[model samples]
Target: MSSTPALFRLAAACAAAALLAGCAVVSVASTAVGFAATAASLAVDATVGTAKAVGSVVMPSKAEDKQ
Candidate 1:
């Protein structure tokens, strides 16, 4: 499972590097909005992880549910 992501990352990096040889990439003024969206998404994920961790430690599922 974990190896797949590494393989994908390697392929994506190679492709990105291949496309960046002396090329002029166009820029837009929407970077701030993109950054804000990414930060908000990351914040939400962290919040959810924290809530799950606390919940599992505090009020775990009943033993019968594991059957």
Candidate 2:
């Protein structure tokens, strides 16, 4: 089974938790931590998606073209 979806779900969960923590913690330090975690999670998700798209691109090679 592909792990990408599972990874996305996990990231989403992390982001949700961070948002909830921001609302519940109510301290400056905790709010900052929650925001940081949310940002990091989004960054990771974007990076992984970009990496997958880049990795999936196929370039035509001279050898393959001749076949």
Candidate 3:
């Protein structure tokens, strides 16, 4: 679970949302897009954090590495 992959997903989602929103003329649609972007950002952050926490549990410590 690399941060790079998670960030790429977030970027792709935002791009898709922006592209899909171009045909609309309503304020609510724009608001929804904004909300979607926010949600995507949060989701990426949470996923990356979770992956790091799990890796910390499974990965070897510095003392183990030295051996």
Candidate 4:
């Protein structure tokens, strides 16, 4: 199955143009917002992962055998 929103949008736009003679609100900003949120979440996840890898506070494996 196809899940491409852009393809659907292009089809809708084409239909609208063929049916009407005016403009349409294409909701490009909502798509941009989704992209921005996705990028931000990915960045935050990467930062947390890097901190866990390099700067994470490690607890003692043992009293004297702590890492």
Which candidate number has the best lDDT? 3
- Encode model 4's per-residue lDDT on 1-67: one tens digit a residue: 4668889999999998866643323466667889999999999999999877764356433555653
Off by over 4 Å in 4: 1-26, 56-67
RMSD of each: 18.9, 21.6, 21.9, 13.0
Q: What is the lDDT of residue 35 in candidate 2?
A: 96
Candidate 3 lDDT by residue in tens digits, 2-58: 999999999999998987787565777888999999999999999999998998889
Q: TM-score: which candidate is best?
A: 3
**Which is the better candidate, 2 or 4, if ranked by lDDT?**
2
Q: Alpha-carbon error at 31 in model 1, in Å? A: 1.0
Error of model 2, residue 8, in angstroms: 55
Instruction: After the best TM-score superposition of candidate 1, give how far the Cα of residue 38 lies from its true spot, in angstroms.
Output: 0.2
TM-score for all models, in order of appearance: 0.50, 0.47, 0.51, 0.47
Cα lDDT, model 1, residue 38? 97
- Winner on lDDT (1 vs 3): 3
By TM-score, rank the candidates, best first.
3, 1, 4, 2
Arrange candidates by lDDT, highest first: which order? 3, 2, 1, 4
Which parts of model 1 have CA positions greater than 4 angstroms off?
1-28, 64-67
What lDDT does the true structure give each of the candidates?
0.82, 0.87, 0.90, 0.75
lDDT of 1 at 12: 97
**Model 2, range 1-67, lDDT digits (tens) per residue?**
6899999999999999999988776787787999999999999999999987875676555677799
Between candidates 2 and 3, the lDDT winner: 3
